[model samples]
Target: MTNEAFQQLLQGGVVLLDGATGTNLQQAGMPIGVCPEQWILENRDVMIDLQRRFVEAGSQILYAPTFTGNRLKLAEYGLDDQLGAINQGLVAISKEAAQGKALVAGDMTMTGQQLYPMGELTFDGLVDVYREQAQALYDAGVDLFIVETMMSLQETRACVLAIKEVCDLPIMATLTFEKDGRTLYGTPPEAAVVVLQNLGVDAVGLNCSTGPADMVETVRKMYEYATIPLIAKPNAGLPELDGDKTVYKTTPEEFAQDGRLLIEAGAHIVGGCCGTTPDHIRALHEAVCRLTPKAPHASHHRVLASERQVVEIKLDGSFQVIGERINPTGKKKLQAELRAGKLDMVRAMAREQERNGASILDVNMGTNGIDEKEMMLKAIYEVTGVSGLPLSIDTSSPDIMEAALRIYPGRALVNSISCETEKRKKLLPVVKKYGAMFIALPVSDNGIPKTLEEKHAVLDELLADAYDHGFSPEDVVVDALVATVGAAPTSALDCMATFSHCKQDLGLATVCGLSNISFGLPDRIYVNATFLGMAIASGLTMAIANPSQDLLMNTAAAANMLMNKEGSDLAYIHRMQYFDKKEAERKRQEEAELLASHGTAGAVETAGESQDAEQGPVNPVYQAVLEGEKAAVVALAQQELAHCMAG
Candidate 1:
C-alpha cells in the first residue's frame, strides 16, 4: 500500500517476487498467440488464482500482468486502443488477488522496437508510450512500478523519465543481458548502474538472459558499483526445443539453489523470468527466507556519460575537452551556413573535433535571426547520427533545453545555469528530471563572480539549489566563471584559483571556457594553450575550447603525457606519423595523375627513385601529410585554397 510497506518487506531480508506470469498463464490453458491481457480480462478467476498461488507460495511483491499492455506492444495485435482498459484491468485484478497481503507492483516491460540510433523509436515517442501506462497504473492503485525485461538502456531511461513525469511511485527496473555480460547494444553493467541509479530507481539488475548461475555473476559485478538495491529475475536456465514444445531444463530445486546464490550475491529481490513457476518461487522462498541482505557497495558518480561510455571525472586523469568550436557565437561563416540549413559544415566539424580527441562536443546554434531551438535540435540530430561523441547542449532557454533534452538519445551535459534564482528555479528541475549534467557557472546577481571567494559563494548556492532539486553533486560540472585576462589583469590568477577550489575544496568535477583566458590577448592560441596546461595541473578536469587549434591540441597531447595518460606519447607519435605516411601515398597518386593530364613541372627525381620517366612534378600536399610535416601541410592547404578561390 505504501513504499514504507514495500521497503519493510525488503528490510526483513531478501524479498521474494512472483514468478513468470506469461509462463504460468500459458500453462493454465491459454491459447498460443492469444492476447494475454484480453484473455486475463475475460477470465479474471484464472488470473487471480495464478497470482494468489504466488502469494501463497511466499511472494512478497506481486507484479501485475501488464507487461505487454503498452500501446506499441499491443499495436502488434491491433489492440492499441485497448491499452488503458487493459493496464487498469490487470492492476485491479492483481490488487484484488493480493487482498492486502502482498505489495502489488504495476508491471511494465519492453516494447519490441529499438531506440533511436539503435532503432526507429524516438525518445519522445517512447516517453508517450510509458506515460499513458504509468497514468493508468497509478489510477489503478498500484504500490510501485517495475520495468522488466528491458533490452535497451535508452528505452529504459525514457520509460523512467516518462513515469517520473506522471507519478513518483518507486520504480524498480531491470535490463535483459546477453551471454557476453552486456546488453546487445553493449551497455555494460557499470553503465547500467550509472544511468539507472542516478535516475533514482528504487532497484535495478539483470533479467531474462540467463539462469541463476549467470545472474549471480552479473549481480556480483553490479554490486561493485551500485549503491541502490539490486533485483535479480533470471530464467530457469536456458530453454531447449523438445519435439514441437519448448522446455526449460533447470528443475525447481536447481532454480531455488540459484536464487539462494543470487541473494547471497547482493540482490535484494529475487524472482523468476521466462520459464519460472509458482513451485519455483516456493522453493526459492524457502531457500533464501533465512538469509540476510548484504550491505550495498559504495557508489561512484562523477562521470560524463553517453549511451555507450561513461567517462569518469578525475583531476589526475586525462582531461575531458569538450570541443567549443561548434558554436556559432562569433563564427559568422558557420552561422550563415546554419541559417541556410546547410549542416554539411556542422557534420564536418563534429568529425574534426572527434579526430582531435575532443571527448564531448559543445553544440551551440543560438543566433539572432534563426529559431535557436529548431536549429539546435536540427544540428543535434545531424551530429549525433554521425558522431559517437556525447554532447554538451548550450542553451539558455528553458523551452529549448527541455526540447533538446527530450530528443537527445543519450545523457548530455547542459552548457550552463547560474545562481540567478529565477533561472535556477526554472531549469534545475528540468536538468534533474532528465538526469543531465550541467555547467554550474559561478554567477550570482552581483554578476559573474570577480573574486575567488565570490565565485565560491555562488558555487555554494548553486550546489544547494541542485541538491534541493534531487541532482547529485557529480552532475554539477563547475565552470568556475573564467574571465578574460585583458579585461582584468588578475583574471587569469583568479580563474585558476576558483578552478582549483572547485575540485579540491568542493570535491567536484571542474570545467572552464578556457578561451576566456586568451580573450583580447595577443597571439591568443599561445596564451590559451599555456593556460590549458596550467589549469589541468591545477585540477581542472574538463575544458571547453576550440579543438581545431593546432597549438592547443599539441599542448593537450603533451599535457596528457605529463599526467600519465596511458599510451599518450606513443598515441601522439602514431597519429602524427600515420598522417605523414598517408600524405606521401596521396602525393604519389596525385603526381601520377597530373603527369597523365598536364605533363609534369619538367623536373626529374634522383635517378634510382624517378617515377616512370614520364611522371609530372610531385604534388607537395601529398608529401606534407605523408611526411607528417604539419607546418608544411598547413602551408600547402592554404596555398591550395588560395589558388582554388582565385581561379
Candidate 2:
C-alpha cells in the first residue's frame, strides 16, 4: 500500500501487521550479535520464507529486515558505510519474498545507548542518524517507516521529526515501557500520548515490553490520549528463560484473546512482537476478523476522563454517590441553625459540594430542635434546583425519608436503613415502595457492630430485609459506617473490616462517611484522605466526603485511575489544565497589582522626564493615574471623590 493508502487503512477497520522478526530469524539460525539486516541479504532463502509466513498469517503490512539498519546501530557491526546497499537489498529481497503481496515498512529500532540529559547523544545527532536511515529506506521505495522500541520521548520526537523531514512516508511509532506501566525514563502513558501526539506521529502505542493482560491496560490508557490509531504488538505474555533459550508460554489462541481485548480497547492495528509466531498472527487475524467492527461515530462519542467512571443514568454501573455535605451535626453554623429550626445551611452545603465534583450530594437534616421530616423536604428542593447531580437523602425518620424521596430526581440513594428491628420494618419498606436505592449500614438497634463478624451478621440481616423490601444486591450500598478513629484506636481497622465483609462476602458495593474515621484527630484531613484511599483499596465503590478539599478530591481522582474507572492520565491532565488556567488568572491579577503600585510610577517618571524644562512641573502621580494603572487610578479617583464630598 502507498503511504497515503496506509493512513486511510488506519482510519477504517482493524488491519493486521506482521509478527516477531528477531525470534523467527533466530529460530532459522541467524547469528546473534550480528546484523539481522545483513543476514537477510546473505540468507535470502530464510528471509523470503519469513516474509511469506507473515503474509499467510494475514499481515497486510510486513516490515523489511531493517530494524538495525540505521547509521549508529549499523556502525556497531562495521556496516555503517553499507546503509544504501543494505536497505536496497532488504527491499529487493523482501519484494521477491513477498512475490508482490505484502506492503513493506522500513523498520527502525533504538540506538541502544543513551541520549542527552542522560547520555552524550545529542538530539541533532540522533535525528541525523534517522534522517540518513529514512532517506535510504524511502529512496529504496519502502511503504512506511516504523520507529519501534523507543523509550525516550526526546529521542523518539527527534527520530520522528528527522524521518518525516527526509521522507514523506507514514510513521508508526511505538515506545517500550517496563512492566510497571512506565518507560525506563519514567514516562507514563499519558505523558507519552501528549508528547507523541504533539510531535505529529501518525500512530502511537506500546509494544515489546509487556504481556497481553498488562498490554490491554496499556492500550486502554493509550486510547485516552490517542487521537491517532493505536498499535498493540505485545509478546505472548512475558518471556521466560527455558534453559538457554527464552520461551513464551502463552499459546496462539490465548494471545489472540488478548489481541481481541486490545481491539476492544480501541486499537486500530494488532500484531505480535519479539516472541510471536505466524501461528500467533494467524489466530489473531481470525480472532480480529470475526469480530464486527465498532461504529465510527459510536466510539468517537464515548466520553472518558481521568480514570473517573461516569455515573450514567442506569442503576447498574457504579454511581457517583456524592457524600452529602449538608449535615449541620458537626458544623457550628448548621448546629445553631438546627437549634433555630432553620434549614438554609443544608442548601448552601449542597450547592457548594455539587459544584466541586459531587455527583450525588448527601442531604442530612438530622440535628436536634428540628422536625426532621419538615427539614428534609425544604433541603431537597433547595439542593436539586441548584445542581442536577443526584441527591443521597439521609435520615432515619420514615416520614422525613418518604418526603425527600418523593421529590428526588434520577436514581436517589436512601441513607440509610439499619438492621435495627424498627428501621427494617419502617425505613426498609419505604425504600422498597419508592424504588430508591438504600444504604444499609452494618449496625443493629444497639448501634454499629464492633467486630467484623458482627457487622457481617448485621449486613446479612440488612440484605435479607432489603430483598424483602424488594431491592436487589446492586441497588444497595452497604455503608460500612466509619467510626471515629480517636474514639477507639481500632475504629479504623473495624471500618476497614466492615468494608471488606460487605464487598468480599456479600458481593455488595460499599460507601462510608469517610470524614468520621478521622474526626477528633490532629491532621484530620490527612487521616481522612488516607482512610479514603485505604477504604477504596478494600473495595469501597463509593464514598461520602467533601470533594472540594484538594487532599480529598485528589484522593478520589487518584482512586479513579487506580481502580481503572477513569481511562488514565487523561483525567489528571484535564484537572491540571483547569487548575493551570485558574492559576494563570491569579498570577495575572497579582502581576497587574504589582505593576499598578510600582510599575505605573516608573512609567510616569520616564514619560515626564522625556518632556523639555520649558513645560511647567508635570505631576508624575497624575500622569500615573491617567495611564490607567487601576490601583493608581483607584487611589486618585477615591481622593477626588472624597474632595467632592467634602466640598
Candidate 3:
C-alpha cells in the first residue's frame, strides 16, 4: 500500500471507497454548469458535512471534490493560473473534514480535451496537467490520487503516469464504462487492465457507469487477469428526470443487492458512483465486508495505448502510419508560415494525413533562427486539438522535447534517442518519467552503424541504456537505418535486412522514413510506394511518411489487404469512394472548360447552371408562412414533429 492506512484496510477485507461527490454536492444545493471545486471552496461547510455523512456511512476512502480542478478545465472560468491554489485549497478542506477518520484522496480527472483519435488532447499534456494538480494535492497533503470517471483509457493512463512522476502516493485509476462493459470510446475491460496493471496502479476498476449489476461481468473480466486489487464503484442504476432534478433509480437495498455480484466476481473494493447516497454507501459497506477477494490470473503484459483505444501490437499485427507532413523539415512554405506565426497549413496537413489514414502524425517544427520549442508546442496543440490524432514529437533539443511532451494530450512517440551520452542522460529520463513510447536511432560513438553486426551492437547498447532508465522493449520502436541509395546503392538492400532482422529475429517493431528510399529520384511517390510495399511485406510495422500521396496510400492499403489485414479493406473502400468522386469532379471540370470554349456566352451559361445547383428547391413551409398562412404553418410544424418522433 502506497498509503499505509488504506493498505491496512485492504488487508482486512473490501476497502470502502466513497459515493458520488457531484450528486451529493448537488443535493446540498451545488448547481450544474458550475465548477464543483470552486463551489465547494465557497461553501466549505456543505462539502465537509457531506463528507462526514459518507465517513459515518462507512466509506474509508473519500475522494476530494477536485474533479475538474486542473488548469485546462479551470481555464474556462479564467482560473487556470489558480490551479495550485485551488487544488491546495481542496486538499486542505478535505483533510480537515477527514480529521483522522476516513482517508481523503486527491481527486483528478480529464481536461475535457478528448485525447487523440477521438479528440484533441495529447498524453504528455495530460500528464503535465495532472502532475501540476497532484503536486499541489501532495504538497497540501493527501493520502493518494483518485483519477475517477475517466471516459478514455489513454487519458486514465496519462493521469496515473503523471501522478507516479510527481508523487509516491497510492494511485487508484477507475474508468467510466457503458453498460456493455467497455468505455463509451470502446476500451473493453481486459484491454484497460492490460494498460493500467502494466503501469503499476494500486487498484483498477469501473466507476460512474450504469450500475453495480451491469459492472459485474466487467469486474469479472478484470479479475481474470488483475494481480492487484480490483475496484467496483458504479452508479445507482442510472439517472432519471425527477421533474427538474435528476434522481437515482436504485434504492439503497437494491443497490447493495447488486454489490454481491461484484463481490462474487472478485472485487476487492466496492462503492457507488453517481446518484448514490450515504445510505447507498452504508449498505455497500456492510455488504462488501462479507465478501472476499479471489485469486488472480496472468495476462499479456505489453500495452501501448491512445486516449480512446488500445493498440495491441502482437508479434505480427497490423501496420501503422505516422504521417510526416506535419513537420516543417524541408518545406520552405511551411517553414516561412510557421516562423511567421501561422498554423493554418499545419492544421490542413494534419487533417489531410488523417484523411489518408495516418494512424499518427509526426510533428517537427525545428527551423533555423526560430523558437523551436515554442513552435513545436504550438504545432502540437494545433495538430492535436484540430486533427485529434496521435503524434510523434520530432525534435533534437531536450528542452523542446520536454516542453512538447509535457503539454501533449495523448501518449506521444518520441522521434529519437542515440548512444550520445549527454543526449541519453537528458532524454531517457524524460521518456521514462512521462512513460511515452519512443523510437530508437542507435547511433554510437562510432557513428551510424553500417553493418548488421554494428547495428545489433548499437541496438544492444540502447536496450541496456533504456532498461537502466526503467524502460522496456515494448516501449521502443527501432528506426530502420534506411540509408539512401544515392549515398550507397546497397543501402536499400541493407535497410531491408535490418528491418527483417528487427521484426523477425529481434522481436522488435520497426519504423522507416519511407521517402528516404526514393531520395533524389523522379516520380518519388510511386518509388516510395513501391518501396513501402516491399517494406511492409518484409514486416515493417510502422513508417514515417507523407500519407497524403495517393500512390503511397494506395500501396499501403493494398499491402494491408494482401497481408490479410482485418477490416483494413474498409479504409481502402472509402478511399475508392473518394477517388471515384474525385474523378467525377475532374471530368465535370473538363467538360465545363470544353463548353466554355465558345467564349463569354458559354461561360455565362455555365455560371448560371452552377447557381441553379446551389439554390435547389424552395421550401413549402417557408412559402406558406410568408403568405400569412398561420394555420397551415402550424399544421406543417406539428406534422414535422410527429414525423421526427416516428422516425
**Can you write out model 1's per-residue Cα lDDT over 121-153, one digit (the tens) per residue?**
777888899999989899888899999888878
Using TM-score as the yardstick, the better of models 1 and 2 is: 1
Give the alpha-carbon lDDT of every model.
0.81, 0.71, 0.79
The TM-scores, one per candidate, come to 0.85, 0.48, 0.74
TM-score of candidate 1 relative to the true fold: 0.85
Candidate 2 Cα RMSD (Å): 22.3
How displaced is residue 485 in candidate 2, in Å? 52
- Name the best candidate (by TM-score): 1
Cα TM-score of candidate 2: 0.48
**Residue pairs that clash (backbone atoms under 3 angstroms), model 2:** 306-571, 307-566, 308-566, 323-544, 324-362
Q: Residue 133: error of model 2 in Å?
A: 0.1
The number of clashing residue pairs in each candidate reads: 6, 5, 8
Tell me the tens digit of each residue's lDDT in model 3 across 138-221: 887888888888887767878887888887889888888776667876677776775576566878888886888888888888
Error (Å) of candidate 3 at residue 381 is 1.7
Sort the predicted structures by TM-score, highest score first: 1, 3, 2
